[model samples]
Target chain A: MARYSILVTSSPFTSNGGANALAYCQQLVRDNHTIDQVFFYQDGVFHANAFMHPPSDEPNSVKQWVAFHEQTNTPLVVCITAAARRGVLSQQEAEELGYNAYNLLPPFSQTGLSDFFTKLHDSDNLVQF
Target chain B: MATITVRMTTPPYQGISAQDGLDFAMAATNYGHEVQILFEGEGVAQLAGQLTPPTGMKSHTKRLKALPFFDIEELYYCTQSAQARLTDGQSLAVAAEPLSADGVKELMNSSDHIVTF
Candidate 1:
């Protein structure tokens, strides 16, 4: 099985890209392919926001992504600069930025572009959405 | 080191995709990777020489021109896209090579990884 790294660049609710990416990842795992990392950049960082509260009947992308990470043991990374610029902050970032609240979901770590490049260097395929 | 081709299809300043894509490419080079940038679809508009962005917005043209300094010299644009969008006498700000559809496909096939924005 080939190794894959995913880059999600669109918001979860704004477009189908995020959901499609998640679906793709699930398929990859089911097929026994190794997913090295799922790096969220641009508006894709919204997927890591713990504050996301979708209607019960709607698909909860954030929760789905969190579950995917739990099952597959893949690293869920969000670009720190992009996440901060879009206000999706972790507890440490919130404290540092002097914000009262944090929304970065668990199992998802904030990182730099170099972290992504390192993973990409090791992966056989890099899929973007 | 791997060769990573970053394909950009979004116009500049509409959102942060262009800047983020560039940042990703630049960072890849820092890790000793070779980066090639391809501007296709509306992304070709970003290469127009005389871009005057709205007030307070960062100039993508300026950043794009600085790619060579970062060792990102493999800049390319889709010839058909450029011809359709760029009017006569409109110059490109960067010295990007024009590639045919087949050339683009070959570039993607030859790269170790492909990232799109």
Candidate 2:
């Protein structure tokens, strides 16, 4: 299986960007490709927010992502700089920043863009959406 | 040798994507990685000269000049798009190569990594 990384840079609800990434991840695993990680940057960090509760009729992206992670064990990482500026905080960061709310979804880690380049070293390809 | 192609298809001032894309190319160069910057679609406008930014915003249009110094030199703008939007007598601030549609595909195909912004 070839190793791959995915970059999600757009918000989930506003567009199909996040969903498309998720679908690709699922397909990748089904195709037997190894997903090194999914790096969420810019406005894309919103996919880490567990607070999103889309209407029952509409597709729930985070649910799909969480389930995808469970199925593939693919790691979800969000850029800490982008996440902080957009108000999606990690557990420790929310406490440190004195913010009462933290919406970061579980199984997702807050990381730096430096980690992105490092991950690229081992990843065979980066399929950005 | 891994050649990374960074496609800047977004405009400046509207968001940080354009600036960040440029930054990635610079960083890739510093890390001893080969990178090419393609200003396509709306990104074609980012290279135009004589931009006036409303106070406090970093002028990305002007920042293109510094890119050559960083050794990230293969600056490209789409020929079709540039010909359409760029007004007569206006030129890009950077020394960029104009790529045709086929050229765009060939460049992307040759690159090891294609990062779109």
Candidate 3:
């Protein structure tokens, strides 16, 4: 199976880009392709927000992603610069920065955008949705 | 040696996506990849030469001008969308090329990878 790396750059709350990326990722895995990782950049960091509480009946794209990672053991990395600017902090970052709350939870970690370039090289396909 | 295409689908002035797309394309060049920047859809507006942001706002023109210095000269805007701007008397950023629908198709078909913002 070819490896796939998906880059999601829009907030899950603001647009369908995050959901779209997830669906694409699912299709890739369903086709017997392997996912190297999901690199979240720009507003896409919102997908990592642990505190996200979607209203009832709304598709919880964030949890859907978490479940995907849980199923396939694929790694998810959020762009550090973009996540920080938007206040999508990991628990450690929130404690260090003295923020009242933190959102980045399990199944998602942080990395620089440059690190993604290397990951891209290792992947058979890189799709940004 | 990989041919990477970064396609921006939104205008730079509207949000950070366009700027971030440019940044990644530049990063690809830094990594020695053959990077091509393609502006599509509303992204075509990002290549307009008449962009003049109010004082204190980032000047996209300045950032675009720096792309050539990075040896990333393969810049193009969709010809299908060009009519939207040409009909309004707008022109692309200096030296930015036009990519016909077929050319865009060719790039996607040939590139090792495609990333859109």
Candidate 4:
């Protein structure tokens, strides 16, 4: 199976990218392909939020993603620039930076948007979902 | 190296852009050419699941899946875009590498032809 790198840069509820990103990952796993990583940038950082609460009746896409990451140990890296632009800060970081607590989680790590470059370079294939 | 990367710049269901993009990718793959799909801006929505297409429209996600049959296995999403704007995780169901600015630039560079829809 060929390995791939999928990038998700849209919000889950706002438009289309959110749902598509999750579906793509699931199919890849089903195909028995290796996913090198999933990088979150621009408005895509919210997927890393641990407290994302959708209605019980509604299918929880974010929760499903969390489970995917947890089960697969997939690395979900959030872009620091976009997160800061959207004012998504941790409790401690928010207090230190004079902001409100917007998100807190462990499956995600914050870094520069440029960090994902190496992943793309080394990837056997790249497809955007 | 006539590798082509199909870049999605529009959101799904907004218009025919996503469908059009998929059609083009499929055509290329059917011709036995290397094809890749990259989502930027709102294009990442193409991978979002649970979408009810407007009226008679078919889901772009379904079309996206068929790409592999044509050997168009390259699919990517902007991780930065997904995290910053994505409201829910269910919408994005693909395995992707979140791309940075540099990654995008490099993708553009590596591709022999970049088609944006």
Top candidate on lDDT is 1
lDDT of 2 by residue, A1-129 (tens): 899989998788677889889888888888999999899988888888888888899887777888888877898999998899889998888999999888885789888876777777788988888
C-alpha lDDT of all candidate models, in order: 0.89, 0.84, 0.83, 0.71
| lDDT per residue as tens, model 1, A1-129 | 999989998898789999999999999989999999999998899999989999899998899998988887889999999999999999999999999999996799989888888777788888888
Give the proportion of true interface contacts each model preserves, from 0 to 1: 0.90, 0.29, 0.57, 0.00
Query: Which model scores highest in TM-score?
Result: 1
Ranking by lDDT: 1, 2, 3, 4
Which runs in model 3 stand beyond 4 Å of their true positions? B87-91
For model 2, residues B1-117, the per-residue Cα lDDT tens digits are 368999988877767888778777776776667888998998888888778765887888667778877788898888988888787667678788989999999999999999988
My TM-score estimates for the predictions, one after another, are 0.95, 0.91, 0.88, 0.52
For residues B29-109, what per-residue lDDT tens digits would candidate 4 score against the true structure?
555457788998888776777777898988776776677787877778777777665776555655556688888888889
Q: What does candidate 1's lDDT look like per residue over B8-117, in tens digits?
A: 88888887778777888888998888999999999998888778877888888898888888899999999999988888767789898999999999999999888888
Q: What are the clashing pairs of model 2?
A: none
Q: What ranges in model 2 sit over 4 Å off?
A: B30-32
- Tens digits of per-residue lDDT, candidate 4, A1-129, equal 976666666776787777887778888889988888787765677776666778899767567777888888777777676676676665666788886665846667776534554455455665554
Please give the C-alpha DockQ score of model 2: 0.49
Q: State the local distance difference test value for candidate 1.
A: 0.89
